[model samples]
Target: MTLNSNFREAYRQAQSQDVIGPNVIPKALPFVGGGLILTALGVYGGLGVISNYPNAFMPSFWVALIAEIVLFFVARNVAEKGNNATATPILATYSLLSGYTLSAIILVALSTSGVGLPGIGIAAGGCGITFIAARQIGSNLSDRDGMALAQTVQLGLIALIVVLLGQLLFSLFGIYTPGWLEFAISGIGVVIFAGMAVVDFYIMPRSYKDEQYLSAALGMYLTYINLFIFILRLLIAINGGGRD
Candidate 1:
Protein backbone atom coordinates (compact mmCIF):
# COMPACT_ATOMS: atom_id res chain seq x y z
CA MET A 1 0.00 0.00 0.00
CA THR A 2 1.03 3.60 -0.58
CA LEU A 3 2.43 5.75 2.21
CA ASN A 4 -0.61 8.03 2.11
CA SER A 5 -2.96 5.07 2.46
CA ASN A 6 -0.94 3.77 5.37
CA PHE A 7 -1.14 7.13 7.10
CA ARG A 8 -4.86 7.41 6.45
CA GLU A 9 -5.51 4.02 7.96
CA ALA A 10 -3.42 4.86 10.98
CA TYR A 11 -5.31 8.13 11.37
CA ARG A 12 -8.68 6.43 11.10
CA GLN A 13 -7.73 3.91 13.72
CA ALA A 14 -6.51 6.65 16.05
CA GLN A 15 -9.70 8.67 15.63
CA SER A 16 -11.93 5.67 16.29
CA GLN A 17 -10.04 4.30 19.24
CA ASP A 18 -10.66 5.76 22.72
CA VAL A 19 -8.42 3.89 25.07
CA ILE A 20 -4.73 4.08 24.27
CA GLY A 21 -4.11 0.46 23.31
CA PRO A 22 -1.61 -1.42 25.41
CA ASN A 23 0.95 0.85 27.06
CA VAL A 24 3.29 1.69 24.15
CA ILE A 25 5.91 3.10 26.45
CA PRO A 26 6.86 -0.31 27.77
CA LYS A 27 7.45 -1.86 24.36
CA ALA A 28 9.09 1.25 22.96
CA LEU A 29 11.58 1.57 25.79
CA PRO A 30 13.55 -1.50 24.74
CA PHE A 31 14.02 -0.28 21.17
CA VAL A 32 14.95 3.20 22.34
CA GLY A 33 17.40 1.81 24.87
CA GLY A 34 18.95 -0.60 22.39
CA GLY A 35 19.26 2.08 19.72
CA LEU A 36 20.98 4.40 22.18
CA ILE A 37 23.45 1.75 23.20
CA LEU A 38 24.36 1.09 19.57
CA THR A 39 24.69 4.79 18.94
CA ALA A 40 27.11 5.17 21.83
CA LEU A 41 29.18 2.29 20.57
CA GLY A 42 29.20 3.76 17.07
CA VAL A 43 30.29 7.14 18.36
CA TYR A 44 33.17 5.74 20.40
CA GLY A 45 34.26 3.51 17.54
CA GLY A 46 34.08 6.47 15.17
CA LEU A 47 36.16 8.57 17.51
CA GLY A 48 38.80 5.89 17.69
CA VAL A 49 38.90 5.50 13.89
CA ILE A 50 39.14 9.25 13.40
CA SER A 51 41.88 9.57 15.97
CA ASN A 52 43.92 6.88 14.26
CA TYR A 53 43.40 8.37 10.79
CA PRO A 54 42.75 12.09 11.15
CA ASN A 55 42.43 12.57 7.40
CA ALA A 56 39.52 10.12 7.24
CA PHE A 57 37.16 12.16 9.41
CA MET A 58 35.56 14.22 6.63
CA PRO A 59 35.18 11.28 4.29
CA SER A 60 33.82 9.07 7.01
CA PHE A 61 31.33 11.73 8.06
CA TRP A 62 30.01 12.22 4.53
CA VAL A 63 29.68 8.48 4.01
CA ALA A 64 27.88 8.01 7.30
CA LEU A 65 25.59 10.97 6.58
CA ILE A 66 24.57 9.56 3.22
CA ALA A 67 24.01 6.11 4.70
CA GLU A 68 21.92 7.58 7.48
CA ILE A 69 19.72 9.51 5.05
CA VAL A 70 19.05 6.41 2.98
CA LEU A 71 18.45 4.20 6.00
CA PHE A 72 16.10 6.76 7.54
CA PHE A 73 13.81 6.82 4.52
CA VAL A 74 13.84 3.04 4.29
CA ALA A 75 13.05 2.68 7.97
CA ARG A 76 10.21 5.18 7.70
CA ASN A 77 8.74 3.26 4.79
CA VAL A 78 8.95 -0.04 6.64
CA ALA A 79 7.44 1.40 9.80
CA GLU A 80 4.62 3.12 7.93
CA LYS A 81 3.82 -0.21 6.32
CA GLY A 82 3.74 -1.75 9.82
CA ASN A 83 6.65 -4.09 9.18
CA ASN A 84 8.22 -3.92 12.58
CA ALA A 85 10.72 -6.68 11.95
CA THR A 86 12.29 -4.89 9.00
CA ALA A 87 11.80 -1.43 10.47
CA THR A 88 13.54 -2.21 13.73
CA PRO A 89 16.85 -3.21 12.19
CA ILE A 90 16.72 -0.34 9.71
CA LEU A 91 16.12 2.14 12.51
CA ALA A 92 19.00 0.68 14.48
CA THR A 93 21.29 1.03 11.47
CA TYR A 94 20.24 4.63 10.97
CA SER A 95 20.92 5.43 14.61
CA LEU A 96 24.37 3.92 14.45
CA LEU A 97 25.22 5.75 11.25
CA SER A 98 24.00 8.98 12.78
CA GLY A 99 26.32 8.48 15.70
CA TYR A 100 29.20 8.12 13.29
CA THR A 101 28.33 11.48 11.72
CA LEU A 102 27.90 13.05 15.14
CA SER A 103 31.31 11.91 16.28
CA ALA A 104 32.92 14.54 14.07
CA ILE A 105 31.14 17.30 15.95
CA ILE A 106 31.91 15.69 19.27
CA LEU A 107 35.58 15.62 18.36
CA VAL A 108 35.49 19.29 17.43
CA ALA A 109 33.87 20.18 20.74
CA LEU A 110 36.46 18.18 22.61
CA SER A 111 39.33 19.78 20.74
CA THR A 112 38.05 23.25 21.53
CA SER A 113 39.59 24.63 24.72
CA GLY A 114 37.20 24.68 27.69
CA VAL A 115 34.22 23.57 25.60
CA GLY A 116 34.29 19.80 26.09
CA LEU A 117 32.71 18.50 29.27
CA PRO A 118 30.68 21.59 30.16
CA GLY A 119 29.08 21.84 26.71
CA ILE A 120 28.19 18.13 26.66
CA GLY A 121 26.77 18.30 30.17
CA ILE A 122 24.62 21.32 29.36
CA ALA A 123 23.29 19.83 26.12
CA ALA A 124 22.50 16.45 27.72
CA GLY A 125 20.75 18.14 30.65
CA GLY A 126 18.76 20.40 28.35
CA CYS A 127 17.62 17.41 26.26
CA GLY A 128 16.57 15.53 29.40
CA ILE A 129 14.45 18.44 30.59
CA THR A 130 12.97 18.98 27.15
CA PHE A 131 12.03 15.29 26.81
CA ILE A 132 10.31 15.16 30.20
CA ALA A 133 8.37 18.39 29.64
CA ALA A 134 7.41 17.33 26.13
CA ARG A 135 6.11 13.98 27.40
CA GLN A 136 3.94 15.75 29.99
CA ILE A 137 2.55 18.18 27.44
CA GLY A 138 1.96 15.46 24.84
CA SER A 139 0.20 13.15 27.29
CA ASN A 140 -2.20 15.91 28.32
CA LEU A 141 -3.18 16.97 24.77
CA SER A 142 -6.47 15.74 23.35
CA ASP A 143 -6.38 13.82 20.08
CA ARG A 144 -7.67 16.64 17.91
CA ASP A 145 -5.27 19.11 19.45
CA GLY A 146 -2.40 16.69 19.10
CA MET A 147 -3.16 16.33 15.38
CA ALA A 148 -3.23 20.10 15.01
CA LEU A 149 0.11 20.35 16.78
CA ALA A 150 1.54 17.76 14.41
CA GLN A 151 0.56 19.84 11.41
CA THR A 152 2.17 22.90 12.92
CA VAL A 153 5.32 20.91 13.59
CA GLN A 154 5.41 19.73 9.97
CA LEU A 155 5.41 23.31 8.77
CA GLY A 156 8.06 24.27 11.28
CA LEU A 157 10.21 21.39 10.11
CA ILE A 158 9.96 22.56 6.50
CA ALA A 159 11.03 26.07 7.44
CA LEU A 160 13.89 24.70 9.48
CA ILE A 161 15.08 22.65 6.50
CA VAL A 162 15.10 25.75 4.32
CA VAL A 163 17.09 27.65 6.91
CA LEU A 164 19.58 24.84 7.24
CA LEU A 165 19.97 24.66 3.46
CA GLY A 166 20.70 28.37 3.39
CA GLN A 167 23.36 27.91 6.05
CA LEU A 168 24.92 25.10 4.09
CA LEU A 169 25.07 27.19 0.93
CA PHE A 170 26.59 30.10 2.78
CA SER A 171 29.23 27.84 4.26
CA LEU A 172 29.98 26.35 0.86
CA PHE A 173 30.64 29.85 -0.49
CA GLY A 174 32.80 30.73 2.51
CA ILE A 175 30.48 33.52 3.58
CA TYR A 176 31.48 35.17 6.85
CA THR A 177 28.87 34.84 9.58
CA PRO A 178 28.59 37.21 12.48
CA GLY A 179 28.93 35.58 15.90
CA TRP A 180 25.46 36.65 16.95
CA LEU A 181 23.91 35.40 13.71
CA GLU A 182 25.46 31.97 14.15
CA PHE A 183 24.25 31.81 17.71
CA ALA A 184 20.78 32.91 16.70
CA ILE A 185 20.51 30.27 14.00
CA SER A 186 21.63 27.52 16.33
CA GLY A 187 19.25 28.77 19.03
CA ILE A 188 16.39 28.73 16.55
CA GLY A 189 17.29 25.15 15.60
CA VAL A 190 17.22 24.11 19.23
CA VAL A 191 13.79 25.62 19.77
CA ILE A 192 12.30 24.16 16.59
CA PHE A 193 13.59 20.66 17.24
CA ALA A 194 12.45 20.78 20.86
CA GLY A 195 8.97 21.68 19.68
CA MET A 196 9.06 18.88 17.15
CA ALA A 197 9.97 16.47 19.91
CA VAL A 198 6.92 17.60 21.87
CA VAL A 199 4.67 17.06 18.88
CA ASP A 200 6.14 13.66 18.13
CA PHE A 201 5.77 12.52 21.71
CA TYR A 202 2.23 13.86 21.88
CA ILE A 203 1.12 12.15 18.72
CA MET A 204 2.55 8.71 19.36
CA PRO A 205 -0.07 7.65 21.87
CA ARG A 206 -2.78 9.45 19.92
CA SER A 207 -1.89 8.40 16.38
CA TYR A 208 -0.30 4.99 16.68
CA LYS A 209 -1.82 1.69 17.80
CA ASP A 210 0.02 -0.52 20.29
CA GLU A 211 1.30 -2.91 17.63
CA GLN A 212 2.89 -0.01 15.79
CA TYR A 213 5.50 0.33 18.46
CA LEU A 214 8.33 0.32 15.94
CA SER A 215 6.87 3.30 14.14
CA ALA A 216 6.38 5.13 17.42
CA ALA A 217 9.88 4.32 18.58
CA LEU A 218 11.36 5.52 15.30
CA GLY A 219 9.55 8.84 15.58
CA MET A 220 10.72 9.37 19.13
CA TYR A 221 14.29 8.33 18.37
CA LEU A 222 14.53 10.76 15.46
CA THR A 223 13.29 13.58 17.63
CA TYR A 224 15.74 12.77 20.41
CA ILE A 225 18.68 12.66 18.00
CA ASN A 226 17.80 15.95 16.35
CA LEU A 227 17.22 17.57 19.73
CA PHE A 228 20.66 16.51 20.90
CA ILE A 229 22.33 17.85 17.75
CA PHE A 230 20.63 21.21 18.01
CA ILE A 231 21.35 21.52 21.71
CA LEU A 232 24.97 20.63 21.11
CA ARG A 233 25.24 23.24 18.39
CA LEU A 234 23.73 25.88 20.66
CA LEU A 235 26.23 25.10 23.39
CA ILE A 236 29.10 25.19 20.93
CA ALA A 237 27.96 28.60 19.72
CA ILE A 238 27.83 29.88 23.29
CA ASN A 239 31.28 28.56 24.00
CA GLY A 240 32.65 30.14 20.83
CA GLY A 241 31.18 33.50 21.78
CA GLY A 242 32.78 33.37 25.20
CA ARG A 243 36.16 32.85 23.59
CA ASP A 244 35.66 35.77 21.22
Candidate 2:
Protein backbone atom coordinates (compact mmCIF):
# COMPACT_ATOMS: atom_id res chain seq x y z
CA MET A 1 0.00 0.00 0.00
CA THR A 2 1.93 2.99 -1.25
CA LEU A 3 0.93 6.40 -2.59
CA ASN A 4 4.21 8.20 -3.02
CA SER A 5 5.28 6.47 -6.23
CA ASN A 6 2.00 6.47 -8.09
CA PHE A 7 1.11 9.98 -7.02
CA ARG A 8 4.42 11.31 -8.31
CA GLU A 9 4.02 9.47 -11.59
CA ALA A 10 0.56 10.92 -12.09
CA TYR A 11 2.05 14.36 -11.58
CA ARG A 12 4.65 13.64 -14.23
CA GLN A 13 2.01 12.38 -16.60
CA ALA A 14 0.18 15.68 -16.27
CA GLN A 15 3.38 17.63 -16.87
CA SER A 16 4.53 15.78 -19.97
CA GLN A 17 1.23 14.85 -21.56
CA ASP A 18 -2.05 16.71 -21.86
CA VAL A 19 -4.46 14.28 -20.25
CA ILE A 20 -7.20 16.86 -19.89
CA GLY A 21 -9.11 19.00 -22.37
CA PRO A 22 -9.30 22.79 -22.58
CA ASN A 23 -12.92 22.54 -21.44
CA VAL A 24 -11.61 20.94 -18.26
CA ILE A 25 -10.73 24.35 -16.88
CA PRO A 26 -13.99 25.92 -17.89
CA LYS A 27 -15.92 22.96 -16.52
CA ALA A 28 -13.90 22.62 -13.33
CA LEU A 29 -13.96 26.30 -12.36
CA PRO A 30 -17.72 26.25 -12.10
CA PHE A 31 -17.60 23.09 -10.04
CA VAL A 32 -15.39 24.86 -7.51
CA GLY A 33 -17.43 28.05 -7.51
CA GLY A 34 -20.75 26.26 -7.39
CA GLY A 35 -19.62 23.97 -4.62
CA LEU A 36 -18.71 26.96 -2.49
CA ILE A 37 -21.96 28.70 -3.23
CA LEU A 38 -24.13 25.71 -2.30
CA THR A 39 -22.07 25.16 0.82
CA ALA A 40 -22.89 28.68 1.97
CA LEU A 41 -26.57 28.20 1.35
CA GLY A 42 -26.68 24.86 3.14
CA VAL A 43 -24.82 26.26 6.13
CA TYR A 44 -27.21 29.14 6.37
CA GLY A 45 -30.27 26.97 5.90
CA GLY A 46 -29.21 24.45 8.48
CA LEU A 47 -27.83 26.85 11.11
CA GLY A 48 -30.20 29.73 10.68
CA VAL A 49 -32.25 28.35 13.55
CA ILE A 50 -31.12 31.02 16.01
CA SER A 51 -34.72 31.87 16.86
CA ASN A 52 -38.32 31.67 15.70
CA TYR A 53 -38.91 28.26 14.11
CA PRO A 54 -36.52 25.92 15.84
CA ASN A 55 -38.55 22.84 14.95
CA ALA A 56 -38.31 23.85 11.34
CA PHE A 57 -34.62 23.04 11.48
CA MET A 58 -35.04 19.31 11.86
CA PRO A 59 -36.26 18.53 8.36
CA SER A 60 -33.10 19.91 6.82
CA PHE A 61 -31.25 16.86 8.03
CA TRP A 62 -33.32 14.46 5.96
CA VAL A 63 -33.28 16.91 3.09
CA ALA A 64 -29.53 17.01 3.11
CA LEU A 65 -29.21 13.25 3.18
CA ILE A 66 -31.63 12.75 0.32
CA ALA A 67 -29.93 15.42 -1.73
CA GLU A 68 -26.59 13.73 -1.34
CA ILE A 69 -28.03 10.41 -2.48
CA VAL A 70 -29.64 11.99 -5.51
CA LEU A 71 -26.52 13.84 -6.58
CA PHE A 72 -24.41 10.75 -6.11
CA PHE A 73 -26.39 8.90 -8.74
CA VAL A 74 -26.58 11.94 -10.98
CA ALA A 75 -22.82 12.40 -10.93
CA ARG A 76 -22.26 8.70 -11.41
CA ASN A 77 -24.59 8.66 -14.40
CA VAL A 78 -23.09 11.77 -15.95
CA ALA A 79 -19.59 10.40 -15.70
CA GLU A 80 -20.77 7.09 -17.11
CA LYS A 81 -22.19 8.93 -20.07
CA GLY A 82 -19.22 11.26 -20.66
CA ASN A 83 -21.10 14.47 -19.93
CA ASN A 84 -18.63 16.99 -18.61
CA ALA A 85 -21.19 19.75 -18.38
CA THR A 86 -22.84 18.09 -15.42
CA ALA A 87 -19.70 18.29 -13.33
CA THR A 88 -20.28 21.67 -11.72
CA PRO A 89 -23.89 20.98 -10.83
CA ILE A 90 -22.99 17.64 -9.33
CA LEU A 91 -20.28 19.24 -7.20
CA ALA A 92 -22.60 22.06 -6.18
CA THR A 93 -25.32 19.65 -5.12
CA TYR A 94 -22.95 17.58 -3.06
CA SER A 95 -21.45 20.66 -1.41
CA LEU A 96 -24.84 21.91 -0.34
CA LEU A 97 -25.65 18.48 1.00
CA SER A 98 -22.46 18.49 3.08
CA GLY A 99 -23.08 21.97 4.50
CA TYR A 100 -26.62 21.03 5.34
CA THR A 101 -25.56 17.81 7.03
CA LEU A 102 -22.98 19.62 9.15
CA SER A 103 -25.57 22.19 10.09
CA ALA A 104 -27.85 19.38 11.27
CA ILE A 105 -25.11 17.86 13.38
CA ILE A 106 -24.20 21.21 14.91
CA LEU A 107 -27.84 21.62 15.76
CA VAL A 108 -27.78 18.17 17.32
CA ALA A 109 -24.86 19.22 19.47
CA LEU A 110 -26.67 22.31 20.64
CA SER A 111 -29.85 20.43 21.36
CA THR A 112 -28.12 17.77 23.41
CA SER A 113 -26.49 18.31 26.80
CA GLY A 114 -23.09 17.28 28.35
CA VAL A 115 -21.11 17.94 25.16
CA GLY A 116 -19.14 20.71 26.94
CA LEU A 117 -16.38 22.93 25.61
CA PRO A 118 -13.65 20.37 24.93
CA GLY A 119 -15.91 18.23 22.82
CA ILE A 120 -17.09 21.19 20.81
CA GLY A 121 -13.54 22.35 20.33
CA ILE A 122 -12.29 19.01 19.04
CA ALA A 123 -15.16 18.59 16.65
CA ALA A 124 -14.76 22.10 15.32
CA GLY A 125 -11.04 21.70 14.81
CA GLY A 126 -11.44 18.41 12.95
CA CYS A 127 -14.16 19.86 10.78
CA GLY A 128 -12.06 22.91 9.90
CA ILE A 129 -9.21 20.67 8.85
CA THR A 130 -11.54 18.56 6.74
CA PHE A 131 -12.92 21.65 5.03
CA ILE A 132 -9.46 22.86 4.13
CA ALA A 133 -8.55 19.49 2.76
CA ALA A 134 -11.66 19.46 0.62
CA ARG A 135 -10.64 22.77 -0.89
CA GLN A 136 -7.13 21.51 -1.65
CA ILE A 137 -8.49 18.42 -3.38
CA GLY A 138 -11.02 20.35 -5.41
CA SER A 139 -8.48 22.90 -6.56
CA ASN A 140 -6.27 20.14 -7.90
CA LEU A 141 -6.57 21.46 -11.44
CA SER A 142 -3.97 18.87 -12.37
CA ASP A 143 -3.34 15.21 -11.74
CA ARG A 144 -0.46 12.79 -11.43
CA ASP A 145 0.55 9.42 -10.17
CA GLY A 146 -2.06 7.95 -7.89
CA MET A 147 -2.28 5.29 -5.23
CA ALA A 148 -0.61 2.02 -6.02
CA LEU A 149 -2.78 -1.02 -6.66
CA ALA A 150 -2.13 -2.19 -3.12
CA GLN A 151 -3.04 1.13 -1.51
CA THR A 152 -6.20 1.43 -3.54
CA VAL A 153 -7.31 -2.07 -2.56
CA GLN A 154 -6.43 -1.45 1.06
CA LEU A 155 -8.42 1.78 1.17
CA GLY A 156 -11.50 0.06 -0.18
CA LEU A 157 -11.28 -2.61 2.46
CA ILE A 158 -10.72 -0.07 5.21
CA ALA A 159 -13.65 2.01 4.10
CA LEU A 160 -15.88 -1.04 4.12
CA ILE A 161 -14.76 -2.02 7.61
CA VAL A 162 -15.28 1.47 8.92
CA VAL A 163 -18.79 1.71 7.50
CA LEU A 164 -19.78 -1.66 8.88
CA LEU A 165 -18.34 -0.89 12.29
CA GLY A 166 -20.12 2.43 12.39
CA GLN A 167 -23.44 0.80 11.58
CA LEU A 168 -22.97 -1.93 14.15
CA LEU A 169 -22.03 0.55 16.83
CA PHE A 170 -24.99 2.75 16.05
CA SER A 171 -27.42 -0.18 16.03
CA LEU A 172 -26.16 -1.40 19.37
CA PHE A 173 -26.52 1.93 21.10
CA GLY A 174 -29.52 3.23 19.13
CA ILE A 175 -27.32 6.26 18.45
CA TYR A 176 -23.71 7.23 17.74
CA THR A 177 -20.84 5.48 19.48
CA PRO A 178 -19.75 7.13 22.71
CA GLY A 179 -16.89 9.41 23.72
CA TRP A 180 -13.37 9.20 22.30
CA LEU A 181 -14.23 5.97 20.55
CA GLU A 182 -16.42 7.84 18.12
CA PHE A 183 -13.75 10.45 17.53
CA ALA A 184 -11.17 7.80 16.74
CA ILE A 185 -13.50 6.14 14.27
CA SER A 186 -14.30 9.45 12.61
CA GLY A 187 -10.66 10.52 12.47
CA ILE A 188 -9.72 7.31 10.70
CA GLY A 189 -12.62 7.71 8.33
CA VAL A 190 -11.43 11.17 7.39
CA VAL A 191 -7.95 9.95 6.66
CA ILE A 192 -9.17 7.06 4.53
CA PHE A 193 -11.52 9.35 2.64
CA ALA A 194 -8.69 11.76 2.03
CA GLY A 195 -6.60 9.00 0.58
CA MET A 196 -9.51 8.02 -1.62
CA ALA A 197 -9.51 11.57 -2.94
CA VAL A 198 -5.93 11.31 -4.12
CA VAL A 199 -6.54 7.92 -5.63
CA ASP A 200 -9.69 9.09 -7.37
CA PHE A 201 -8.06 12.25 -8.67
CA TYR A 202 -5.46 10.13 -10.38
CA ILE A 203 -7.91 7.46 -11.47
CA MET A 204 -10.23 9.89 -13.22
CA PRO A 205 -7.63 11.28 -15.58
CA ARG A 206 -5.85 8.01 -16.11
CA SER A 207 -8.83 5.73 -16.62
CA TYR A 208 -11.66 7.64 -18.18
CA LYS A 209 -11.36 9.10 -21.66
CA ASP A 210 -13.95 11.72 -22.68
CA GLU A 211 -15.34 11.77 -19.16
CA GLN A 212 -12.07 12.82 -17.55
CA TYR A 213 -13.41 16.12 -16.28
CA LEU A 214 -16.68 14.69 -15.05
CA SER A 215 -14.91 11.82 -13.40
CA ALA A 216 -12.69 14.28 -11.58
CA ALA A 217 -15.74 16.03 -10.21
CA LEU A 218 -17.25 12.71 -9.15
CA GLY A 219 -14.08 11.74 -7.33
CA MET A 220 -14.00 15.07 -5.54
CA TYR A 221 -17.65 14.68 -4.57
CA LEU A 222 -17.07 11.28 -3.01
CA THR A 223 -14.17 12.68 -1.06
CA TYR A 224 -16.32 15.41 0.44
CA ILE A 225 -19.18 13.04 1.21
CA ASN A 226 -17.01 10.59 3.09
CA LEU A 227 -15.12 13.34 4.92
CA PHE A 228 -18.26 15.15 6.09
CA ILE A 229 -20.10 12.00 7.22
CA PHE A 230 -17.19 10.86 9.33
CA ILE A 231 -16.64 14.32 10.78
CA LEU A 232 -20.32 14.49 11.76
CA ARG A 233 -20.06 11.21 13.57
CA LEU A 234 -17.04 12.50 15.43
CA LEU A 235 -19.03 15.50 16.59
CA ILE A 236 -21.83 13.28 17.81
CA ALA A 237 -19.32 11.20 19.74
CA ILE A 238 -17.99 14.26 21.53
CA ASN A 239 -21.47 15.53 22.29
CA GLY A 240 -22.43 12.29 24.10
CA GLY A 241 -26.08 12.36 23.04
CA GLY A 242 -27.01 14.21 26.21
CA ARG A 243 -28.99 12.04 28.71
CA ASP A 244 -30.14 9.56 26.10
| TM-scores of all candidate predictions against the true structure | 0.85, 0.61
Off by over 4 Å in 1: 1-22, 241-244
After superposing candidate 2, which stretches have Cα over 4 Å from the reference? 1-30, 49-51, 86-91, 108-169, 172-176, 228-244
CA lDDT scores, all candidates in order: 0.71, 0.54
Backbone clashes, each candidate: 0, 8
Candidate 2 lDDT tens digits, 1-244: 0012122333334444444553443354346446656775876677776345678756756766777767766765675567666655675667777677666555666665655345545654664575466446634634323334325535554565756667677779777444666566666766666665545444445444544555545444445545555655556665565223
lDDT of 2: 0.54
RMSD of each: 4.4, 7.1
